[model samples]
Target: MLAGKRILLIIGGGIAAFKTPELIRALRGAGAAVTPVLTRAGAEFVTPLTISSLAGEVAHGDLFDLTHEAEIGHIQLSRAADLVVVVPATADLMAKMAQGLANDLASTLLLATDKRVLIAPAMNVRMWEHAATQRNIATLKSDGVLFAGPTDGDMACGEFGPGRMVEPLEIKSAIEAALSDGPLKGRHILVTSGPTHEPIDPVRYIANRSSGAQGTALAEALRDLGARVSFITGPASVPPPAGVTVTRVETAREMQAAVQAALPADAAIFAAAVADWRVENAASKKMKKDGSGALPTLAFAENPDILAQVSQMTSGRPALVVGFAAETHDVQRHATEKRARKGCDWIVANDVSPETGIMGGSENAVTVIDDKGAEQWDRMSKADTARRLAARIAAALGAS
Candidate 1:
């Protein structure tokens, strides 16, 4: 997919820098020409000779190389690449980019680049979770910088929890997605996934059995088709897909807020199984069993109707708004009714009765209901269902 693409690869100071040579090989194997830039701190971890050798290009360093500076090489290098990639994007390097600091060649190139920038962050757990680093990450994301991974795993610092750089293959996949020009290119799609948890106390909560697998798969499919996906997810067994902006929310209200924040989308998919009610007077502490055997009474409040609200928006509504219905009986009839009640363009209805094993299972049988009629799809893997749905969405939007 990346054939004839030019990638300006920037290596940052981090233990994960050792993986960049493999990443370079992967990019080159995909027919992308790599121009490597080794940071001074990155040089301590891997030699410039190794980077240059793998990339088949001279490793650039030193912003003040007199020979290159005479020709404004930084400007030339920045503009020459189709994409700029940062491997092992250190906390310091991220902060520099967030603040638009150009103290070195790599930073200068990043600032000067006209193309999209993708970063794979690697750092210790505490550093990754630190407020400053998180702030920098948010800043960079808002500035349109793409992130592949700093996924959860064991870090080189002998710690764990979301600071590991994803493997080379994953980064390679992300780069391919970034360079793709598919049917949904330039479209912004919003997807909500998982089961929202309505807290009853410090420990207890109300939730459903949505594993988020189908929603994750849908986001991945949309991403592969070159759509910029804003994925708002709740607590679920499945993880979010790579190459999409992920927003984590816990409750129905929080999901609603996140959905509002990711507005003006070309399409919106409401796949989350949000709790219908929340405890109005939830306990701050865990509710204990009373010796008197008197059960505690909890007041219930209706959760926000995200699908209905978004579908019935007066302004700034998405061109295509899709909702999901997990019904136990009369799936098609109920789904058709839901489409009208929610004011959504389409409703993907599925029978999730225990007999069907579809709710939290890997396979799904769905019927897509729209103004025309109900179109039933045979039972298939969730991944396949997602791909089919994504294709339908692409065709629908294209015709729109």
Candidate 2:
């Protein structure tokens, strides 16, 4: 996906800088021509020789070097690449970029470059959660900057939270996405993911095994294609992409209201595993186990169907409506029937039976059913599926 692309890498000063050599190699291996820009402070963490050796080219550090400026100027270099990638995007660099400060060559290029910017932020957990960083990230996303990951894990500071740079492979994918033409650009897409937990009491509720991985990935992929994504998600195990506007809901009804509020979308993919039924009469207080000879009888009531509601809208209905089918038996048949009943354009069916292990699992095997026919895909990582689906969406949106 990154073939023939000129990737300008800006390495920031952080412990995460130790990962840049691998990133440089990853970019080159993916058939991208790499240009390394080392921040003055970045030099302390990783040697220029490492970057030069991996990229097979000399690295650039100083902004005022006469020889470097005379040939390929900083301004020109910044705008020359198809994409600008910031690895270990430090909190300082993020602040500078957000505030339009160009004291250094890196910041100057970032501000002056015409190319799309992709940032992989890596910092301490506290720093990441800090109000300033969050504010900067929000602003950057609003400004159309692309961000890959800051996966949650142990940090160099010896504390764990949410401030870790994404792996090189993930960044590579995001870069490919950035370089690709905006497929769903100018389109609005609404997607619901995860499992809604219906409260029966203060301490207990009904829930499903949905990881929200597929739906979250779909939303991110849509955003990568330049679509404006509005996400209505139940309590997801995983967080949604930073760029997407998300509304959190706990029950099927809450999700429905959130979806309806985000109307007039160009398309919607209902991937949430909404409960078919909730306790007809939920306990106002926590129900305790009392000395009883028999178990308590609970009555259930049906929940509203969100997909059908959105797809069957009389006014301002999206051009495309997509639904998900998670079934243990007769998967494709059920999905085909669902497409018609729900008034949707597509049904992405996946078997979540215990044997499939897809429920709350990272990998998935999906069969897409539409008016055309069913196309079953080999079981692969959910992230890969997201990429393939995003490409198809771009194509479809283009034709539409």
Candidate 3:
């Protein structure tokens, strides 16, 4: 699908830079012509000769090389490609790009590029979570730069958190989505995912078995279909999709607020397993375990019903509002009732009984219930289910 497309691949400094050769192979396998540009720091991790060998083209660098500048200057290099991608986008490189400081060839091409730019960030978890880096990322997103990965996993620094760069295959998929003429183009969708943590104390909280994989997969599917997605996620185990706008929260109330802020979408999917109650008198600090043989009384308060509120909106309701009913018994019957009660257009019903291992497992078997009735689906991978749902959504929206 990417036949004849030109990709400018910018290699940044990080441990993940070693994967650039594989990334080049993936892009080339997808019929894209890749032009590599290595940074001074990037050369420390991977040699320019190796990059050139993998890409089958001369890797470009040196901001003041008169001969190379005369042949294909930074401006031409920036404009020549359909997309500019940064693999292992280091914290320093991202900072420079965000600030529009083009002191080097890579940063200069980034600053000068009119074409769409995509970055796969790779850094230490602490560096990735730094306030300055977060601000720069937000700025870059606002400026319409695309991003992929920096997904959750163990990093090179031996700390396990969300700083690992996504695999090359994942980046290739994002590239295709960014360039494809899919069915849901120009549409906006809202997706909620993960289990909310209703804190009882500073460190203690109530949560569920939601891994957020299905929701993340669904968001990716929608993005692949060309929809602009607002991903409102709680404390999810899985990272959010590459191309969507993500709003992360911890509590049910915060998720509700984030959902409210992401308004007027074409569709809304409530895949989050939200908590039904929260501690009425949640402790500000950690509750002490005094050896007085006294058990503290805990009070509960009802949490906001996000699905019902959005479904019953008098104005600006999404064209389709889909809720998930994870039932332990009477799946179809309960899901049908839930669809009516919540006033949503559809309910994706699944059996989440402990024995089924559906809550955190990779596979899922769901029955989609709508006004027309329940449509039974075969057991499939969560990714497959999401793709089917996205296709259905496209058809429904098109018919409407």
Candidate 4:
């Protein structure tokens, strides 16, 4: 898929940099040329000689090299690649990129580059979640930078939770996607997935049976079609896919806020099973049994109608807005009503009756409802369903 491509690979200073030699081989095996830039710190984990040997190109390291500088090699290197990829994009490096800092060879080349850049972040969990790092991430996304992963896993720091660099193969896939010229190229799609948790107390909340399989699959399908995907997900049983920007939220209110922040998208898909109501006066601490037969009374408030709000928007609305309806009965009628009531372009409805096993299952039977009416689809794997839906979305947006 990457034949004849030129990749400017920047290996950053992180333990994950040790994986770049393998990545270089993978890229080369796919018929791409790799020009490596080894950061001073990156050299601590892997030698420039090793990188140069694997990539079959001189691993550029010094911005002040007399011979290279005389010819403005940095400018030449920056503009020569089809795509620039940073493996183990350290927090410091990301901050530098976000701020347009060019104090070194890597940062300088990044600033000089006219190519799309894809970064795979690796850092301590706290650093990944730090407010400053998150701000930098938001800035980078706004600047049209692509991201692979800082997925949740056991970290080299002996800690866990969302700071591990994605595996080399995943990075390769991301590279392919970054360079793809598919139908959805240059389009930004917003996808909401999983089950929102509405807090009832410090330890208790309301949620659904949604496993987020279909949503995750759909996001990946759209990503493979070259769409820049903004994935706003709730607490899900399945992890969010790589190669997409992920915004994690817990409640319907939080999801609404995240969706709003990810706006100006070309299309939006609302697939989350958000709670309809939340405890109005949730306790600050865990509620106690008190050894009494009576149960604690709870007041409920309706959650925000995110689909309706976005669908009814008078301005900045997505060209296509698709919402999901998980029903127990009368699926078609209720979903049809929902499509008109929400003002969305389409409704993908499915029966989640316990007997159907579709709520948290691997397969789905759905009816795609629109102004043209319902089109029932046979049960299939969530991945297949996603591909069909994504194709439909591509066609819809393409025609519009």
On lDDT, the candidate that comes out on top is: 4
Relative to the true structure, candidate 2 reaches a TM of 0.70
* Superposition-based RMSD of candidate 3 using all C-alpha atoms, in angstroms: 3.5
lDDT preference between candidates 1 and 4, better one: 4
Which residue pairs collide, candidate 4? 152-162
Which residue pairs collide in model 1, if any? Answer: none
Query: Candidate 2: which stretches are off by over 4 Å?
Result: 69-72, 181-192, 197-205, 213-266, 275-318, 325-395
Clashes of each: 0, 0, 0, 1
Cα error, residue 121 of model 3, in Å, equals 1.0
For candidate 1, lDDT tens digit of each residue in 140-200?
8778788887778987778888789989988888888888899998788999999999888
Model 4 residue 39 CA deviation (Å) reads: 0.9
In model 1, the number of clashes is 0
Q: Which ten residues in a row have the lowest lDDT in candidate 2?
A: 239-248
Order the numbered candidates by TM-score, best leading.
Answer: 4, 1, 3, 2
Model 3, span 54-171: residue lDDT tens: 8989998799989878866999999999889999899999999899999999999999999888888998889989999989987887676777866778877789877789888888
TM-score of 3: 0.83
Each model's lDDT: 0.92, 0.85, 0.90, 0.95
TM-score of each: 0.94, 0.70, 0.83, 0.97
